[model samples]
Target: MDEHKSLADNMDEFRKLIQDLKSMSITMVDEDQAVILLNSLPKSYANFIDTLKYSRQTLKLEEIKSAINAKNIENKASGKSDADGLMVRGRSDKRQWKRNGNGLGLRTRD
Candidate 1:
């Protein structure tokens, strides 16, 4: 029927419109824009960035492990034990903190 054909045509057009809209909506950020966004962050975030930079260059395995242990112990003391019931776990251990990138921090695994 003509009605069925028209409906299919309309649906195809709608799908194409959606695809176009999605493609148009996403915009890539240039390096300068990224820098500006980073600059606009809070002082604490800036300090964190500095810490990360310093840590990447100067932190040793012992220092990173110590920090991870300290954070884990603190979390346990605060009653936030991880899945393996571990308070302090290391990178090469069975009960390790789920690492995000190369940062030294603790995160709960649910």
Candidate 2:
């Protein structure tokens, strides 16, 4: 799944599928599973996916799953957690403002 360059959580799902497959005689069709795996990929892979799709490449599930896991691990090691990362989005924390005796503007705690 990772070698297919899928996401970590998505790869986990594939791992689960393989485990579950051992118990059941019936299994999901490889191509459908491949597409499902592809759908789990991030937008950065859009062109790659389109190329693969147009080129009619048959994706190997196990390899893709492995690749995804490795990439996710690499990302985890290199990146910061959401809370620790830069806050470039959404509403910021509210700040309390107060007026001072001098008639000039001032910021104060609530």
Candidate 3:
């Protein structure tokens, strides 16, 4: 649950902890596990957490895992780094240019 760690790494650590607890006769329900995972998310995941929390009546651990994996893939694809939590996006198309009243060139909005 470290903010500096990636989601996959955190989940792996969580799974190991759960396995250790199981060996000690401690167990948690799927919903509780899901809730713990959700609660462990970093502040950067606030929006995602809210959406998942309010959009479901019952939480499924498998579904949450799948969603997290998909989001991780999406973040990677969109030039976001998990450890740094940085995302960069920009338009690749040509921008229009126009001359302002002051005779200076300015980029026009699409």
Which one is best on lDDT? Answer: 3
Candidate 3 Cα outliers beyond 4 Å, as residue runs: 83-110
Error of 1 at 80 (Å): 0.7
Q: lDDT (0-100) at residue 75 of candidate 2?
A: 59
How well is each residue in 36-104 modelled by candidate 2, as lDDT tens digits? 776756665565556655666677666555555565566569783212333578646666667688887
Rank order by lDDT, top first?
3, 2, 1
**C-alpha RMSD values across all candidates:** 24.4, 7.5, 7.5
lDDT of 1 by residue, 41-107 (tens): 3342345335533556454434433443464466568875322233686666344477667786776
Runs in model 1 lying further than 4 Å from the true structure: 1-56, 83-110
Model 2 RMSD in Å is: 7.5
Worst 10 residues of 1 by lDDT: 1-10
User: Which residue pairs clash in candidate 1?
Assistant: none
- Estimate the TM-score for candidate 2: 0.43
User: How far off is model 3, as Cα RMSD?
Assistant: 7.5
Output the lDDT of residue 19, model 1: 60
Looking at model 3, the pairs that clash are none
